[model samples]
Target: MSEKQYLLDKTLETWKGKRVALAVSSEHSFTGIIEDFDEEVILLRDVVDIAGNKAKALIVKIDDLNWIMLL
Candidate 1:
């Protein structure tokens, strides 16, 4: 895997079940506990919208992600 992919893999592995926020290029963000991830996407549980309201879940494409922040 490339460096970026390695970093992502490490992040997913180390932060599993921890709350995090993903920022996208569209300026939208999703916050949730990491549920799972694959090559193309990530599964988030107990998600919250950008406005901070709770959501059941969120599936976000990996390519759309700009950054990840631990919360």
Candidate 2:
């Protein structure tokens, strides 16, 4: 696997079955369970909030991820 893929795999493995904070464009933030992950993106479900309201979100392309915090 490529270095990027390896890193993504490692990150996913480390963060699996955990909640993470996602920061998207427009400074939107959401907390959700990490349902699944791939080289390109992470699938999050059971979204709790976005900026301040209940919402569901799909984060595409790990490169677009500004940051992820396990909690």
Model 2 lDDT per residue over 15-44, tens place? 887888877653667788898887778888
Model 1, 8-71: lDDT tens digits are 8997989889999888777888899999998899899999887889888888999999988888
Q: Quote model 1's TM-score.
A: 0.87
Instruction: Name model 2 segments beyond 4 Å from true.
Output: none
Clash count list over all predictions: 0, 0
Q: How accurate is candidate 2 locally (lDDT)?
A: 0.77
- Each candidate: RMSD: 1.3, 2.1
Off by over 4 Å in 1: none
Worst 10-residue lDDT window, candidate 1: 21-30
